[model samples]
Target: MEYFIQQLINGLTLGGIYALIALGYTMVYGIIQLINFAHGEFFAAGGYMGVILLSFLSANGYLATYPWLCLSGAIILSMAYCSLLATGVEKIAYKPLRKSSRLSVLLSALGMSIFIQNGLMLTQGVYDKAYPTIFSQGGFDFGNIKVSYMQIVMLLITILLLILLNLLVFKTRIGKAMRATAQDKTMSSLVGIKSDRIISLTFIIGASLAAAAGIMVGMYYGSVGYTMGFVPGIKAFAAAVLGGIGNITGAMIGGFLIGMIEIFGAGYISSEYKDVFAFIILIGVLYFMPTGIMGENIDDTRV
Candidate 1:
């Protein structure tokens, strides 16, 4: 029982990370109908940015003196860097092909992904960067189960972000415009909503979320690599699809489910096949409930 509880806690924390990355996938797909394959590269870029920022702080002795502030600064700077990179990618690679065939856009996205990955490798070098041991010391324990303060912090951050995102999409006028554009871009444009601008904002927000997720994962693991985003990105895509691609709520549920499945399967079954559970769930979800938990259709997805 205690072991089960421990796995549950671990699952939720992992799920939160997956959920954050999945939001980027779902939001971009919901708005544009184009899967931004380069989105994962954005995650990698953010991790690298965080590493650089943290390294700078550590070199200057500020990381030791003001740990939280340094962490916050790293997150902000990394997010900003990724957001700008995504924006540029959108403007350069995707914007011109907005009216092109779906296959063309998909090819472009893949091409962009390749470019980003190689660029990161060439610039940052192919190496694993370790985070400074800022939160390595303290936590609370229960029975035979141990939980870290960082896990609690990650959980709270995920919950807060989810709530704010829900309110943003459901309450704001811009959100309504986003929904409107998602339903019918041409019609939304006719109704005086700027579809282009809405789409750009969607990319920006999604990229920012991805970057934030990248920072959290780096902090939790205490290390990151240029290739780190690929597996997690694939898992996040699976989570979005499992919950219902394009459905925000479904993506969140799917993320948690994936996280739990992976952790518990590893705990009770075999650790070597831990990564297989998320894909199995994805296949199960796809084979059984095609529309996802709450999805309507491809074109009618909400923010």
Candidate 2:
């Protein structure tokens, strides 16, 4: 029971990370139909940006005593950087192909992904950098089950963000516009909605969320690498698909499910192949329910 509880906590935390990143994929797909393959790189960019900001603060004596303030600053900076990066990608890489063929946009997305990856490698190097520990060392224990403060924090962050996203998508005017645009770009434009603006906003929101996830992962793991986004990115993409692409709620559920599967499969099956577990589940899901858990909603077809 203790082992089970411990693993559950770990899985939830991991799922939270995947869900946040997966939201980016789903949102982009929901609004523009473009996969935004470079999104994973955006996640990496956020982590690297946080690391740089934290290092600067530490070196400047800004974080010498006010650790919380430094941490807050890093988070804010990381989010901001991610928002700009996302908006820039849309304006530069994707906007040009908005009227082009789907294949053209997809190819551009792939190229953008490679470009960002190599750009980071050249700038930050290929080695892993140690991440600064922001949270105090400790964990709540119960009957041999231990839950780290970082895990709790990650879960809370994920929930808070999820709530915020839900409200934004369901309760706001912009959210309605996004949905409308998703349903039919031509109709949205005819109804006085600027599809381009909605699409850009979608990218911004998605990128910012992914950035938060990246920063949280770096802090939890104590280190980060340029390529860290590759596996996680793929997994998050799978989670989006598993939950049903373009479905926000489905993305959240799928992320948690994937997390549980990966962690439990590692514990019960083989740790060596734990990572492959997500893909296996993905294949099974696709084979049986290609529309995914929520079923693809034609109301909001991918752009």
What are the lDDT scores of the predictions, listed in order? Answer: 0.87, 0.87
Q: Please give, for residues 191-248, the per-residue lDDT of candidate 1 as tens digits.
A: 9999999998889888888888888888888988888888888888888888888989
For residue 270, model 2's alpha carbon misses the true position, in angstroms, by: 0.7
Candidate 1 residue spans exceeding 4 A from truth: none
Instruction: Quote the positional error of residue 299 for candidate 1 in Å.
Output: 4.2
lDDT by residue for model 2 (111-211), tens: 98889888989999989877766563688988798888888888998999999999999999988998999888999999999988998999999999989
TM-score of each: 0.96, 0.95
